[model samples]
Target: MTGSTGDFAGRRIVITGGARGLGAAFVTALAEAGARVCFGDVLHDAGAALAQQLAVQGHDVGYLPLDLARPESVSAFVEAASQRMGGIDGLVNNAAITNSGGRLAGELPVQTWDAVLDVNVRGTWLMCVAAQRWLRESGRGAIVNIASDTALWGAPRLLAYVASKGAVIAMTHSLAREFGAEDITVNAIAPGLTEVEATAYVPGDRHAYYLEGRALRRPQTPADVTGPVLFLLSGAARFVTGQLLPVNGGFVMN
Candidate 1:
């Protein structure tokens, strides 16, 4: 699905790590569906370029600088995005780091672990907190946390990233319960080894493992994950919350 079904027409969405990859896909799809979106990332030039590119195409998209490792940046980004979009109705927590990848748990440095959690776990939480007020005001808010299948399958040498995502899944549950009174839905999606710039560092063997293990038997793309995200943000999933969806071609069914 291209997310151009108009399900999000007139909606205001804020996305994180949206300069490229899955985040960029989300921005593009949502804009195509008539959503006014504002996205953030630490890649300043890229973020600006993406927004400009979308603007040239007549889409209402804005880009801002954000570093999830910094709490101040998280708050500022959310507030700025809300102001620009008039308000926030949906949030996509897609920014994350894998600083501990390829290192054994015993060999993983404490600093590396801390960095991953700071960006992936604490960053996700901060974004939620920053957007909570705006989302509540929307009266029909939705949150989609980008998790990873590596966490569900226990991928070795990825302890920090996996652990952080597991925490995101748990946070989704708690946030759902806490936001339910305001009609905000919180959920997480676990995508398997999608093809993206971030995954370029992954080993060939690891890629092969995911390909061979998947029922679809093909490399996953950012588009594969975007539709599920859009659905979660749409009115269609108003009653669906506190859940984890694995969009890995059945590689790790839940």
Candidate 2:
């Protein structure tokens, strides 16, 4: 699919946490693929700069401020994205946050747990709810939720983040059934420990373990995670739903 960049021409999509890292990669790749894109994130300046940069390059792209921890903000983001793109055909649930590294479940405070679950889990469902009608209007709507392989392999030293992603996988199945009759497909993309700014806190040894254990024996990049997301958002994945696709270079293969 990388051979042609306009496969998604005319498609309108909304993505969460598109200010940087993997989210930024999705935003960039989708826009270059000819999709009308609107992405929301709490990082106002970064999001705006990315949008402006893309727009200057002649891509139909826009950005808005969003705090996924708040219900009102999630609803506003969906609404704003719909208005920007004229309509919505897809939604990417990518916004998430994690506390400092190497904290056990018991060591973590309740507030940390609440914050992660609030944005990673609850925010995802709220986005789907708010985008329901707009997706239905598109005839065939697709939703791609960004999950983590940590949940699949029971990665150690991560409590709240793992639990939240596990919930995302389950929600995908349930939402797929709920949105099926409306011609909406729900799916999740589970990526391994990727090399993003957010992952910089990870220990050097832990990162080495990831590279050594994976079949590819190399690091995973945001670019590597973008193609599968694009496919899941495209017509090619119309028959695919309620499934978790891992993009971790053969790490944690099932």
Q: What's model 1's lDDT at 102?
A: 88
Off-target runs (Cα >4 Å) in candidate 1 are 1-5
Which predicted model would earn the best lDDT? 1
Query: Where in model 2 is the C-alpha error above 4 Å?
Result: 1-6
How big is the positional error of residue 239 in model 2, measured in Å on the Cα after superposition?
A: 0.4
Per-prediction backbone clash count: 0, 0
Candidate 1 residue lDDT tens string, 134-220: 999998888999999888999999999999999998999999999998889999999999999999999999999999999999999
- Give Cα-based local distance difference scores for all models: 0.92, 0.91
After TM-score superposition, the amount by which residue 35's alpha carbon in candidate 2 deviates from its true location, in angstroms, is 0.4
Question: Candidate 2 residues 60-130, lDDT tens each?
Answer: 99998999899999888888889877899999999999772499877988999999999999999999999
Which stretch of 10 consecutive residues in model 1 shows the poorest summed lDDT? 1-10
Tell me which residue pairs clash in candidate 2.
Answer: none
